[model samples]
Target: MLYYATTGALPIPSGKPQYQQPSYYTSGDSTYSVSPPEDLDASVSSASGVASYGNSYSVTTSYAGSSQGEYDSTGSASGVDLNEYMQERFAATFDPLPLDKCTAKQAQTSGHLNAKHRELLELQAKAQARLAKTRARFAQGLEDAREVRNDLEWTQKKVASLKAKASKKHSKEYTKARERYPSPDMY
Candidate 1:
């Protein structure tokens, strides 16, 4: 009699075989069936008796079909050869130059320095051009200021000469004007 602890029920005695034949195990989308050899029962019993005395036991299994089919089928489902595709991708991205670590580092550093040198040269040229342009503008401004100062000085001198002529009392033109329009106070 077999007792089920969880169900708390005892199975009734029946005249049937103790072991059932091997059956299929179903998983998602796949079914697997395993059949034991004719003498597996005897071998397992003997193996179990040996294992009871603290001995190691191992089991080996071999499939009938070629294992390569699994990999080939998976690759074909994606429309490409997996091995070839991986090789091509690896080759495309792999860098094969400068095998030595020190040489690779030196090459990378030199390349960076060369790029920086070119950028510095370009910046220096631009700065020099800007300095030249600013100097030219400054010189032109100074020249214009000098011209304006000279013109202002010339105008001041001309105004002073005209004032000197108009203020003179004994000039011939002034005496003639005085006589032609005799003063009314003198009468």
Candidate 2:
């Protein structure tokens, strides 16, 4: 039977193995009795006294059921200790690792490794940033060089066109002058 401490209600036994109901439950320094239902024809009588523990009291209850005449003093109907059964069921299965396996030196080494990893990541980021800047500068310089080359080609073409025009314009004048001032070899 489960006892509710807050509501002080007696819960009907459900699927649990046959065990004698707890007479009383202790909380802090007070003891509260859990009386059986009236329909069960049971009478509960409790005696309370100060326990060995400081300021705490204990209760001893006598249950007289009509069918059983008197409750089992062992608090178990089948002679099995519930506490021992629970302890066996909930016992730890494995041993904990020794403290020596996790030393302060190992923790310090782990911290140092983590710091170095962070440093490496930061350095890689800086290097990538520098590489990106270098690539951008290289691309800009190539564009500038292309523009300069186009300008130089245009200037050269213009100069060649001007030279051709000047030579064609001066050709007739040069012929007339040469005819007027004949060479001594011709005389």
The lDDT, on a scale of 0 to 1, for candidate 2 is 0.57
lDDT of 1 by residue, 64-92 (tens): 46341333323132345666788899989
How do the predictions measure up, each by TM-score? 0.36, 0.39
Q: For each candidate, what is the lDDT? A: 0.54, 0.57
lDDT of 1 at 29: 69
Candidate 2 local lDDT, residue 34: 56
lDDT of 2 at 106: 89
Pairs that collide in candidate 2 are none
Q: Give the TM-score of candidate 2.
A: 0.39
Misplaced by over 4 Å in model 1 are 1-99, 169-187
Residue 119 lDDT, candidate 2, scale 0-100: 100
The candidate that achieves the highest lDDT relative to the unseen native structure: 2
Tell me how far candidate 1 lies from the true structure as C-alpha RMSD in angstroms: 16.3
